[model samples]
Target: MSKLMIDSFRGFRSFELRCPGHVVLSGVPRAGRSDVISALARVLLPESRTSPTMSDLWQTTITAAATGDTEPGKDEESSDGQPPAAAQRLSSVEPRPYANVEVTLTDLDPELEQLFEGFLERCGPDGCAVAEDQALPGAPWCVRLAYRLVYDSDVEALEQFVYYPLASNPTAGKYTRVPASTRRVLPVVMLSAGRPLQLRAGSPLRRVIDELDPAAAAAAFDVLRSRVTHAAEELAGHDAVAQAVGVALASGGVGACLTDTPLDTAQVGFRADDGSAEALLKSLQPTVNLDAAGPLALASHGSTAAAMLGVAEAIMLATAPGAVILADDFGDQVDTANAEHLAARLRASAGQLWLSTRRPEVARAFDPEELVRLTRHGGERTWHRLKRPADRGRIRAMRQLHTQLLPALTSPAVAITEGPHDLVVYGTVDRQRLPGAAPLSAAGVRLVAAGTGQDGGIGEIPVVADLARSLGFRVIALIDRDKAEEQTIKQIEASCDVVVRLPSRTAIEGAVLAGVDIAKVRAASATLTAFLSQDPADGVPDVKVVEVVKRSLHKKSLHEPFLDALVEETKTPPPMIVDVLNHVAAAASPSYSGPAVIDIPPIPLPSAASPS
Candidate 1:
């Protein structure tokens, strides 16, 4: 069975945030994106907390609120003694008839605000402060802005419970707070891009928190003050984490490229540099609960980095292990690099991070293993989950196309040589030099030979080798057998893969004469030498056949001038020259089977190519 499988679950009828970490829901505006976010908020927050006017009562109350007839934050009495609120509080309650998603805003981190601000600027309409005008048609930009601004501020209050150590102080009207445990939280703040932010810190949430923990209530304001500094420092770094956020904020949509602006690593050390570092460490951030009103929160304004950090603060506080954050239209303002990094980071830090986005760049950035794609069919939501192997295959295919076909299609592969003769040698011997078993013409692999026969020209071999490797090719070195030493072999091997040294010390002249009959030359030399010098008593040659041939070739005209030219030029016998040619001869020999090892004469190394 294949290691990859596509899984689709259809039980969820509308939109739902069944888990938590950081879920971003993004798609073409008005594709029920905001509706999904709203649905998620419905799931996470209690119906009591939701504005009643925006719920089942929506049909009757929406018209009134739109016309400013219904009072904002107006409440009714409930049996539980809590005020009956709007079924959903989007900008203080009113039903919006657009698509969106619901999400959480928790644990605000001020340090990452600047980075998040960049993200917002990138997503901002006409590139300015988030205003209601920026929300696209069918999405309530104004209400979303105000609603989340209020909601995020309330959520930020939650962190005070953890950050400050508590002590009872009856005379002070509140408890004294000191430093507590250095809790590492991955905050996920919900935000909307390009809209006014008008959240008041003194919203009912403050009262509610005070009712829960009066001691924490007094320290809440101080926490917010500290977070502002934290956000400032994170804005000052150059690191991958900050860069990822910056990339997301500097674009029109969530998927964009990583650019040169780096995260400032100096300001926010990875380890807790101080309480100050703690303030700036908003690692995983995203905008959630997006709709027209989503962008009203101050946390949602400014750079993409600032906005994403806001989201990160919310997620860190809201999630636990095995929680699934299903963010529909989650990456509406995310850049490609940031989206990818955020997705991978969330998956690593949390149980499951499910996001909905329609950007192809986002789809491309995601690993096939981690992607869960959603589409609307017959008014119902449908999705496909990709497994690891399928994702891996997709990535591999992309890499192959990028490295190989793109270059060839753009420009022909050029093989630059020192001179025309080098080109000739490359053209003539290339086939023999590069065998089909060792093909080198797909993407990054190219071959260049220096046929000029100049010793100084050989210096380019290393450069060519590097170029080939960079282009993804294995280069094989070929040189003449001119009294080569072991160091020559090592140097060539160090630069390239396979090295083929030419047979017969005469260089190219010998190979041309031998042609395809190199075996004949070997056999004839062996026979003549055995005939000319045989042991009188034994009537047999004591030396190996190849050794006798080498000695004969040395004595002949091919030896002196060829050896002198090659050895004096490069200063070393090209290692493996005779070895490769002999192997070739043996392969073509009648007695050949598989890889036959041919015995050849051992030649002394020349003093030239040796290390100084």
Candidate 2:
């Protein structure tokens, strides 16, 4: 198997993808899943210089100091303290926006050698000045390129070049045009989200045919044509598809044929006597059917057929045996069963299949290690490979819940609370008081309950934090100060980007009690007491106040009415709750700096007769 490593490539800061097996990439939309796939294609097939429509080349402006130059000389400085002509020109050298892509081929073959020879020749001492020094040694069987873009003003041209890094030199290396021969070694087949499995020119079907054995493909087409012709002749019933065309026009009316268009390429199309059949026949382009409502072209069939066709063609065109197959949102249009079946087929095929999807069902079909997640935080993109947990069976048992519980894994930042009650409390306060501010989801942050304390104490905190970090999420473990132990807190703080403990020996319930006004608490307690047919006690302790409110609002859920009443009556959250919310918002916000030590005043111990 070959391993591909990409650094500072488009949205990817650093990542590695191994080939020759099924790998699923998933994340929230616009998290750079497709960009990685396109990067792989560009690396393997260096002839492709332009970026895919879904992504663009990553560009960055470089200051002169970054390129090993000091500030402009005083002689070159203008009287206004501006840089001199020469200083201004050299003040900021763009260094040509670039990305680094490297591939390690385990077993070298003649074809690969030929490809490497061409690549090395372009990067040799005679070519780009940096190529020879930056070229990889033979032992590793690796090819590395610093792909950079240069603009030429005289010619009004912009071009891309691949440079080899020098061993000790940081600023210069050999460079050359992207090697054109790498395409012959490994072909990349990419299926984007919007790409349909149509049988038109430049469509996936056409590309598949072009890659397969011409004679075999032609033979298959003839057989399919004959089958369709036979089926059209037997359409006697008043079926929707047949009735739309009145009668079957001819025996060969539904023949599968190729048309030579002005572009000088053969386009696959089905021939039908009546034009009405065109829509029906086009829908089933992968099959030899004249009926629009046939099993192949049904509403449910379109997605499945499209997915299957791409896989089928990939299997047939195993020209580059271990070719890299990239599909963005692989099963977006297919049902769960069909998507899983397609995934299984790809797993059993010859090439390495990389698929990206947002569907949990599709993600569940693969093992933890086979899944790669992308996340963006603070304007930086990171990739994570899921690792198999020691408690694999426990994870499997909770698979359904885990899938629903961890929406935070897809978000850029996550707030890991102790349990659902805490989640609801904090979430309620955030929504009610800071509605106009950056909400969790709007800021690309998600609040995840890390399982209740009854489940396993705080053990799940480290586990969940590690999992979130592995997927590149900036995590803030909001723990109850009372429940946190010194060692456990230390471990969680080490694993997460931020660790925020609720104010002194208090949980969210305590924080709410300390934050909301006494009058609002009494009113909410009164409302609950009336509903529960209980008398309200005077001078109840803060702890008792929280317990009464909790029980009264059980039927209605605690967060909303209780928090709402607090906000409405008090006009603001208490200091403690506000402090906790501030920490959560900061951690979730993209502008968050780093972990901080927060000081929160201790909640005074409850008086006698306080509820436990």
Model 1: residue 537 alpha-carbon error in angstroms: 77
TM-score of 1: 0.26
Instruction: Give a tens-digit lDDT track for model 2, residues 1-612.
Output: 356677666666677766435688887567787776766666555545674321243555555422233454446556798765544534432323445665544344566655656443222222222344465553334344444444445664555555444221224534554346545445566654443556544455656665567788657656766777656555533255554443333234432222332221122223455434233335453433435655453234555655566666665554556665677777777787877777666656646677787766666666767777877655666667765556884474244235423444456777777766777887786677665455657767677777653553455667677777767777788887766778888887887887787765676667777645455677656644434556343466655765665444534455556676667666776567667767676666667776554446666532334344
TM-score per candidate, chains pooled? 0.26, 0.62
- Tens digit of lDDT per residue, candidate 1, span 263-317? 2334233323344422333322334455565734345554565536634643553
Q: What is the lDDT of residue 130 in candidate 2?
A: 30
lDDT of 1: 0.37
The pairs that clash in candidate 2 are: 129-174, 130-173, 130-174, 131-174, 134-165, 515-574
lDDT computed for candidate 2: 0.59
Model 2: residues with Cα > 4 Å off, grouped in runs = 7-21, 26-32, 43-60, 64-100, 105-188, 194-197, 206-323, 329-351, 358-361, 374-382, 386-406, 515-519, 522-544, 550-578, 589-595, 601-612
* Candidate models: Cα lDDT each: 0.37, 0.59
Q: What's the CA RMSD of model 1 in angstroms? A: 28.9
**Model number with the top lDDT:** 2
